[model samples]
Target: MNLTGWIVYNGYLPGTKFRDFAEWIQRAAANQGIRTTIYKNNHLLSCLTSDSVGLVDTETRPDFVVFLDKDIYLARQLELMGIRVFNHAEAIAASDDKIASYQVLAAHNFPVPKTVIAPKAFYNTGADTIDDYQKAVQLLGFPLIVKEAFGSFGEQVHLIHNQQELTDTIQQLQGRSFMMQEFIASSYGQDKRLHIVGNKVVAAMRRHSASDFRSNITTGGTMEAYQPTQEEERLAIATAKVIGADFAGVDLLIGPDGTPIICEINSNAHIRNLFDCTGINAADAMMAYIQQEMRHNHGRLADLP
Candidate 1:
């Protein structure tokens, strides 16, 4: 497949890790004979004028884009320009918002921990009425998990053990978007991550954190190669498709009955950790999927019968 594209990641993110992701994807594209240019999202300013959306760019637009950031407007702008973006903008938005992701998953009848979305409120404005919070706490019970709608690496998730604790936690959040979920005790310090690409589970790993209730690698979790059960694999694949992801890192929690439940879905899941743990390069799979899709969409798939 002959294609030109752009790989965009956040430029202000202060770390070599994200840039490293872009480079790895670029290398994969190169191996497939696809030419790509890397761009920090900020490098291409999104221009908005009366009746038109465009990017301030002097260079010619590419055939497609591999967007690794959550700049939804920019992704939409690219779509408006007829540039295909991997993991479509709508999907990214759903995945970026924890509340939205759960709503979709529940609508599809997937198994998820009991969850309650906090009502919209301002930071300093008092949620003075603990009445609503009390009802939610009663339904979810103590030791429930309070998670911000928008967060990564388990940093925004907190384990609340009591009514007062819950109130304190919310107060600390200062009106940020958050939700409450039933704590999966069986999966307290360990969870499984299955990376899927184009309907296939490309890699799987178990992440464990002895020191924390959260099992995120960024939060002191350790990784080890693990094989997913058939049910686990099925759930992961279904989840990626349900969320409309080209590729995703689906986190699964162990239900009390030992069944897999969706912990989260990441549209822009970092591949470096998966690579280090499973030795599988998801970028390769991602690039291959993109190429096949691009060619098929352009009526260039050689396998057409």
Candidate 2:
């Protein structure tokens, strides 16, 4: 009656962090009597042939897949073959791109910082095709935030204090997808990360940095276990739902007036930091949720071989 699944991650990424994420999920699944195999994205092939479309040499398909990497194409390919994919491919893609995620949030009336997506072009389209700097400056004012659409751990986020800083940063990011956002000065060096499973916030933590504008734990910030306010919980859960995430790490910034505002949504959030800060194993909660999803879909753990 044990469930079977595959925890897929990007093998191309350096260091043990990526592999470690898969391993943690594997162990958590094991704790719930679910058997899971870890696979690198390169370990499988998504074959397209006139006669058939499938993954090459995939003998037995698992009941579901836990995608820990941002391999959207592979995730979609797996879905095409009839295997259930957690978080879903589209959700991953949306969360992977800051502009896309922000658009979704804005459409849903979620409270996200004011953001302006840069124009698309192979080369820096120059000021001719891009938004007028004066207009952007007027909207967001000085000391705004600039974020590359595709980045992680606050590495690609920059704080621009004036027009020259914005210009230089944009020049360096030519041909890249990015956005300019309103700076939340009150939460400059602090934010809350809430891990959501199903429709509830399971574990929460507050991260703060003494020397930087970003408070991401991966960027030398300190974290402490936190109890989320009702508004914070509501915003986090809503973000996950709108993004179609089964589980996610939702960052909330404290507004100047103490209101909760979404900073970012991570579809494949690393749970180790959350566990370290709160003593709650989000992986365990995710596994349990996956089991319930299977059951709700009329599939039983006994169906696995």
Candidate 3:
């Protein structure tokens, strides 16, 4: 009954409520008699084990790896090693890149915002500007969002209302990769945060912030208990499956048309706000699920093919 738990880092760093939530999960797992390991660096090479039944890393590797990052690159490496990574690499990769995420979700009939990937050349400074920005606006429309290809905690997400803002932001992000997406107007100020574990919707909350444009609690948003509608629950599960995440925090924004658009899918979701506001103990639930999966896999290994 030995369980090895690895956290990306401590949950006490500045503006990282999710990190705090990870710590809470670690504590809760300890209370349940599970062994845990916390990694301060965002590297997976140091955490692999030859005999451990399970391994959790914010990055990817072989040997029972559980990835906690939104990036999919690590998942692919782990998958290549024949390890079972939650949120398979392909799914994480697709979700990490906004343009790719929207394409995959749309292909599968998932509701996602209209999005377009700006050419890398556009940010080159020496490339033609009008054509690139025009293409972006044509595909994604005005009042758009420009997000760094890989970012989290709502840090690199931006809302651009007009051409001036878009130009300024693009210039500021010069030489960096980014994606442009149509801002869901109805989701202007609020959205639902759904936390999923295994295949079930474990805890859900409605997030709102008067002072910030983002609903992430790390961005100063307030959270309250929310009972997801049937459609919302289905969308959350579908998004998780599509993204290949065993556990995830799915952000669903209600469009002006009252449709829920998948704004973001967080592989390493924070549980502190949900726990504090809803009393759901998502950390405990996740630990239990991981342990159960480990046991199930170990049993199968004993039988061999």
Query: Candidate 3's residue-wise lDDT over 194-272, tens digit each?
Result: 9999889999999898876688777888889999999999999899888677788899999887878898887777676
Candidate 1 wrongly placed segments (more than 4 Å) = 300-305
The digit string of per-residue lDDT tens for model 2 on 124-151 reads: 6554432456688899998999899999
TM-score of each candidate?
0.96, 0.95, 0.81
Q: Report the Cα lDDT for residue 159, model 1.
A: 96
Off by over 4 Å in 2: 124-131, 299-305
CA shift of 60, model 2, Å: 2.0
Model 1 Cα displacement at 45 (Å)? 1.2
Please report, in order, the local distance difference test score of every candidate based on alpha carbons. Answer: 0.91, 0.91, 0.74
Per-residue lDDT of 132 in model 3: 62
